[model samples]
Target chain A: MGPDSSQDAQTISQVGEFGLINRVTSGRAQSPGTLLGPGDDAAVLAAPDGRVVATTDVLVEQVHFRFDWSTPHQVGRKAVAVNLSDIAAMGAVPTGLLVGLGCSPDLPTTVVDELAAGMWEEAQRVGISVVGGDMVSATSLTISVTALGDLQGREPVTRSGARPGDVVAVAGRLGWSAAGLAVLGRGFRSPVAVVGAHRVPEPPYEAGPQAAVAGATSMVDTSDGLLADLGHIAAASGVAVDVRTELVEVPQRLTEVASALGADARHWVLTGGEDQALVATFPQGRPLPEGWRPIGAVVEGEGVTVDGDAYAGPSGWEHWR
Target chain B: MGPDSSQDAQTISQVGEFGLINRVTSGRAQSPGTLLGPGDDAAVLAAPDGRVVATTDVLVEQVHFRFDWSTPHQVGRKAVAVNLSDIAAMGAVPTGLLVGLGCSPDLPTTVVDELAAGMWEEAQRVGISVVGGDMVSATSLTISVTALGDLQGREPVTRSGARPGDVVAVAGRLGWSAAGLAVLGRGFRSPVAVVGAHRVPEPPYEAGPQAAVAGATSMVDTSDGLLADLGHIAAASGVAVDVRTELVEVPQRLTEVASALGADARHWVLTGGEDQALVATFPQGRPLPEGWRPIGAVVEGEGVTVDGDAYAGPSGWEHWR
Candidate 1:
């Protein structure tokens, strides 16, 4: 019989807590930074920088993801990706992850196996490991990930460091996840590009430290769209941010998809979120880092604007708004 | 109006994500270890030991706590306490915490405020702070806390180090939370000592590192009762543990309460969990730590026995079994 078939035959309740923990942790290779891995009360990780960057993100089933739209593996990858992106946004390289999972007792064990596999996949991409985690029973599935990172002797780039003269640039894809969400909402999922992007974001993890090495003043991941995230930098730094739309690239693929859906591609490029792209501000006249392209500039004032004017659309996604 | 009256009038949805974040974080004093507090993508914390100890625990409403029995503030304190105790179990001092909260949108903002306050209260007790967190919407309340700690250049006291000639010792109250849970289960709340323990645990956080300094062979916290948690050490260290009933102290108050309820105080002390007490094994000839009392001995065997016999009760609590 296939692994899925056997796994489907068992539920989380049947496997039990210790049994489930063993299944997820056994035989997994740990990174060298993991001084002590799972099975203990806690995990120990090497922090050579003498400081650790920590961030957490919670993803709830139906609220943050839908099983009908994405598989359990995809959900797990996205959950870890979002938190790892937060670490990267701080100009740090991730070292380890701790997951807190709560799910229904009736859920199939296969879902958990797949979810763990996906989380490992994402952590492996950055050479980190899920050093420790907790699993418990709840009414619905909730994935909470805490990613610990090392600054590597570099100053952490925070949102408040963006100066008035700093030029803003971004690396990685934009508008793709948002476009995919629109396609899924319209009940047409044939465009695998956008759909897959929605399921699993391709965050430019390395660009964060790269930007920091190049003396970038501020950095943030594009989790709340370009304009909204930049607004955070502006507010924190006591400066205004203006995006030059002409300089922003709206990929032809997104344009085609938007045209077919009768939506604005530029809006997606400007306000789309969850792409996990890194946006940072650097000193003016300095050559931009590789893979980063200039898209805006910081000025004296407050809030974010597009082409010297406020973008005439919802800036980004907000919970309970 | 009183703070509760005003806060009760506002639901989480009305307060919104950003507003709720501001309410919890504003005016809070961050610890020196917290190089960067909440408000950014991630927080930076000092790991002076060059190795960071991390652990996570998830508490779900009804599954882990009941609103009818405990206040939100107490639940919050318990949640943070559990994670901190895990850090202590590693023979480390906690540095910071990251909370991931998932609750209903219609939940009162007062609950959130109280929860945050309680978390801060517990964190301050250890000279730490809630450095970072994530808030999301879910059907039921779920609190996930991840605690980071420093070993202070000491080797982590893991569970796999106990030897056959080691003496088992415990510091801090044992079975108090379990007694409180039993009282609560019986619908009596007057006995504040035990009932209050059920609400918030007082872990012997300092005893962990102290035990390590005194050359503890192995250490663990009594979150799963003395015998069950000792079972972990026994299995991990390839040894057997025998608890002498005469040596194990059953508090007089617990005995009185148990008699009134027709329960066994010794059983509670042996099998009741969630007291957050520190238990460790020391060399047979070495003196135990200041607060620790010797209660058992390790030998060549497997599993835990009480007074040279198997305890005739449920060993400990397990999530699904």
Candidate 2:
């Protein structure tokens, strides 16, 4: 078995918290940049690029996922995924992750191990290592992940760079996670592929850098709805956004899921979050990349609209109840 | 008045969650390297060192703090302090923070604002900004914080660099937080200073980089008991540690509290956690800088000891009951 394959739910639960942590850190290759891996106050990484891009996210059980709903691996993957998305949004490649976990002792050691395995799997996907973390006992499980990214000699993309006439585009699918969420919330399961989308978000991890290289401005990861995310760009750049739905193409799988679940694919596209798709504004006449699509354009109004009409679905995911 | 001064604890409750967050993000002088401050999918920051140092910590009411014992501001400070300590442990300077909050609506808005105010106040101490965060509703109050640091052309200090003859030293106070915790748990308030220590730990923040500059091989923050943390170093660095009790400097304040409470101050010193002090190893003949005290030396052994003997004390803080 490979580094990731030496994991299982049974072994995960039986391993003590520290034991589980040791397993996660064992046999992993550290970046020549890493001075420390785990089991310390903090892990150190080399920053030859002269600066670092940083972000964090916290996942709470029941709020983000339920033990009954998500396996330990799934939870771990989600924890790392959301934080990695933050780094990707800044057009930086992630280097290391520090995780702080609060869990109930009654939670089997295997469950926590599975979570670590999932995190490791995701960390491998991004070519980064899980460096350091903290573990504490709590009433429920909470995973707080912080990701550090290496910019590698590039300026970070902020939300304030979209010019009024810049063309707006996206490099990944929309509403897929939301469609999966709707299906799960309705006591239904999507097809294996769609269910997998809900279990683990397969973001276009390389697309953010490609867009950056293509001279994109004001890029963001769509963890919220597309309109809500674009609204951020609109507010930051002081430009109105007019998305041409006629040019928007829905993933056929998502449409089938929406159809089976009796939901509008557009609603999911408009409001679903956690897809972590990269959206950016490019100067007019910019050549589009192969995977990117021109779904919208910058305009002279205040809010974002679809095909020139205001979208009235839910604005985005609100953390507070 | 300053951005934080105008808002009193009373009107703060009325300010509501979003309102309080808006206050936290209101006009301020952002640090030089912050590309984006807040209010986006994720905040963008310039990693001047080319690599971001990151760590996460979660604070839960009742488990980490009691509302009765700790004011909201203190809670906020501790939340930030612990994570900042992690960054410091990495021998890096902090640059930004992401905060995710979950609390009951019945919780006062003033409390939330005070939390932010405290977070901001502490953030400035490390030259980092409150770059981004999340807010949500939940059964209890939870503050999950991720801190990002910049490594300023130096390698991060880790737990595995000690050799057989390195001098082990520490660069801050030890055991005050645990002593304060004992006071609170026993329904006795310590004197002003000791009681205050429980609310907000004063870690030797600068000592991190100073130690790094002084050519320390390995370093860790004593948030866990000294032995527990050093045991980690010993295991990773493949060395044994012998801490000298005669050389141990017990804080006089702790002695008084231990006497009044009929507890052992030595226990607090030996096993108490949350000191956030910098403990590091230096090669023989390499002198420790000011603010650091030589405490012990690394040897060829398996575990940690005090006064050349195995210590049978409280061991350390245990999260799960």
Candidate 3:
């Protein structure tokens, strides 16, 4: 059987802890750099370039995702996606993952199996594997994923290197996830694409290392909305970023959905989070890399502005808020 | 101010998520392998030997730690300690950690700060840093820790490498945590040391690499009971392990506490877990390393036998059961 065929209807407690783990991990393929996989004291991954990029993210039920809105598979995929976005932001090639899952013991074992299946499916897309993990019983469902990546001996594209007069660009779509969230909230049957985006964001993973190769000075993943995340870059680089919203291309689907919901599509495009689009700053005359399109420019100042004006709407999603 | 002075009385929502993260991470020192610390999308670490060892563990309130029983500081320390023990079991030198915390929004923000302080304090003991993390709101308090380690060019001593003629030995205390658990269960105010073990286990960190240097054939940490964890080794190695109970020197303190609680000290020594002592198999003629004492030997068969008989007591902690 191919990877991810271990589907069982048994409850976690019925299968027992070890038995459930074995069922979830059965028939998985180990990717390159994973010298050792799960079932060991710890897994080993090769870091040939002598450095590894590491990041972690947590997703909580009701807080991050609701079972009614998304399947367990989608939740699992989203968990890996968010963590992978952080690794991508570092301009690194994703290598491996360690997943920590906390769930109610009474939950059907098939839920965990599906979660593991989705995780493996996503990791496989990036040519990586879930090398190690831990599982525990908890009152609420929670997923914690830590992603490891390799830089291949190149300098990491950090947020602090943006220079005045640099071109600010983006890869992939923005506002999709936020739009998806709205669609779900209003109980509207959004377009399949929009609903899927809300369930599992599609990050521009390859754009990160590609930007680094094309001499991008700074880079970040738009996790907490385009404006808010760019504000981070502007703050760190001691420069101002101006995004000409007109220059940002938004799909017709978003505008259509916004009109139907009596919301401004621009609001989602500017303030939406979890789209995971890669944003970078490059020297003004440098050739933009493939998959990247200029959205605005870096200027001499502080904070982020759209059309040279400070954004007045809600900035982004804050966990406490 | 020192590295861990972020204590405050404000609630998490009052401090705000980012503000609390800044407060908790303030003044911490970067360990040797840390190339980049927090505040970025991710962190970078040096893996000098071209490989990195990784492990993760999750601790949930009520399931793993009760607020009435463990101080938040102890809970935080225990989270890191358990993850570290896995790295140690792989005979690797820990270099960094990525922590994920989920807690009720109503929690006093100082609790998170104290938890972070405790994590930093424990990580400092082994000269590592909390490189990155994610925080979110949940119904229950949860801590997920992923530890990264360097093997330092030595072959990892996996549980499957033991031979029939190899000697079985361990470093660090056994049964103390189990005995301590009984004391706590009885509602008896035990000695500070005993109570401390149950709250925050002290693993013999140095002995992991020491065993590797001494050519340990197989290794594991006794996170599960001695028989259960060693059963893992036995099953993996396709050999039987024979433990001589007489050779196991249980401290008189454990016996005294066990009697006071109307429990069998030997039962705790044989079936209790979470002590995190390093157990390994070495060549029969090889001398036991300092801090390690021989307690058993690998025999020709599968499964573990205590004094040539199967253990009948509870095996160990099972997440489901």
Candidate 4:
């Protein structure tokens, strides 16, 4: 059943803002790092390294996701996952989250309950909690999540540190979400693997700090596709990246799905976004970290290329373009 | 002129997401505590006190403010001010901010420029910066601001620490925003004082730490009116608060405005909200902090009272009510 089909469901307006807040925050277990949780003007968190990594991502219904395509719980998980991935890309471990939710007053409180439950589930995976947040009435459903993390005394892995003769490696799935999106777009849900991947990404959260320990020169999450995000590193570091298709593995599952859809799996692997895979450049002589596979090389130039040739078509997604 | 009346103004879609992001972020100065700024996967801020205070607030167009009554610049300032006030209420000084903006594609880029300028102006006022943010397309203008702060080694003064013998005091203006809102609702904009107060609040940022230093036992910001916020302290601290009308000062300027509009100035002072004022409970013997004035007392009871009596009207604003 759809979220709004229940005629007797309690609307958020009926419960009121304070009531909803209490329902979402009450009786929740917080992590050790959460010094002070919800029910206050602000939340206090332990920053053991004396530094904090913070990032925010906003997801609007229809613009970023669809209620018809994904459940409120899945949407909630995706929202928190995307922001936490940004924190992970910084080579930090997440400490807490603050949510800013805007939804129509007619929205069912059950939707909010499921959404908060999904957020808490994702946060618990990283040993954190939704420490604080704000809720307000709006015309549409908008979720803004801010994920905070601790650096653990390591220097931040920014996009500007890549150098020549560095090997580019990636940890986590690539193009799987795009494959899932394609299946869903074709009105098919049987391939739940790709659809689930598209619904909630499994970002390589620990690989960020692991890469930092492995002396990664630069690191970024493939939220905007591999080549496009690599373009950021190239532009910031004044270097060129060339992805070798032979070294870049296009998973057999994606290939089969692409064959059925009459699409290019290679293109999906190189340009699909939202998978939240961690891509980093490291010195050429050392072994890549476990779970990381070599995919490309950094050269003393600019822009990204596949097999040293520019790939045709749009590189990645950009809003309002 | 209205924001959309400019025929030649470029729309946000024309600039595209990256172009707009670069336009808003380029050449912005960051605070000394910002270890890493925008143009990254995440921002790294120096949390020198080994702990961080975090809060999030969401403001939607029309729901929170109207362009017909206030400029986007004013809206931006109000958004940042409200969040920073939460940090201050925790007895922490703000270090940085992250913004999540969702606007329609047809929105004028000029509006974004002005909004960002106003946000920077307010951030600069507190010696901080907008370190990172996300921008996306939505049907309405939604702004979510996440503020991070440093406690400077002092314990956070939560709302649950008030005692029976505690004195209740306040710093900064009260009922001014509600007065302004009333004036605007009546279509009379001549009194710039109250109108501007409604447009932007002047939260006493330093007064929070000052109250902590002055031995404040419990504290809260008056975002939901003086009496209503005192009710929060009362409920959380398991104590009752009585506001002595004889001791509370209703400013003369508000009186003049109230008289002109045939309204009660004292009532506005008691129940109006959005002043961003700091309210706290302190021990009975010590002198109050500078800029703080005694207004009430906490005792062994429940709920809040106005001059030892129940208030006759609504205490404060609530969303979806």
Q: Pick the candidate with the highest TM-score.
A: 1
For candidate 2 chain A, the 10 contiguous residues with the lowest summed lDDT are A5-14
| Poorest 10 consecutive residues by lDDT, candidate 3 chain B | B1-10
Q: Which model is ahead, 2 or 4, in terms of lDDT?
A: 4
Local distance difference test, each candidate: 0.94, 0.79, 0.90, 0.93
Q: Where does model 3 exceed 4 Å of error?
A: A1-9, B1-8
Ranking by DockQ: 4, 1, 3, 2
Per-residue lDDT tens digits of candidate 4, residues B1-321?
665565347899988999999988999999999999999999999999999999999999999989999999999999999999999998999999999999999999988988899899999999999999999999999999999999988999999999999999999999899899999999988599999999999999999999988889999999989988999999999999999999989899999999999998998899999999999999999899899999999999999998889999988989999
lDDT tens string, model 3, A1-321? Answer: 443444344578877778877887879989977999999889999998899999999999999999899999998899999889888888899999999999998889888988999999899989999998988999899999999999998998898999999999999889898889999999975677888998999999999999999999999999899999999999999999999988898889999989889988889988899999999999999999889999999999999999999888998988887
How does residue B113 of candidate 1 score in lDDT?
A: 92
Compute each candidate's TM-score over C-alphas: 0.98, 0.90, 0.97, 0.98
- At residue A139, give the lDDT of candidate 2: 72
Listed per model, the TM-scores of chain A against the true chain A are 0.98, 0.92, 0.96, 0.97
Which digits, one per residue and each the tens of the lDDT, describe model 3 over residues B136-218? Answer: 88999999999999999998889999999999999988998998888888786567678889889999998999999999999
Q: For residue B207, what is the lDDT in candidate 1?
A: 94
TM-score of chain B of each: 0.98, 0.93, 0.96, 0.97
DockQ of 1: 0.89
> Can you write out model 2's per-residue Cα lDDT over A62-128, one digit (the tens) per residue?
8788766568898899889888887877777887887878776667666776788899899889878
lDDT of 1 by residue, A1-321 (tens): 898778678989999988999999999999999999999999999999999999999999998899889998999899999999999999999999999999888888889999999999999999999999999999999999999999999999999999988999999999999999999899987599999999999999999999999999999999989899998999999999999988999999999999999999999989999999999999999888899999999999999989899789899987877
Q: What is the lDDT of residue B5 in candidate 1?
A: 81
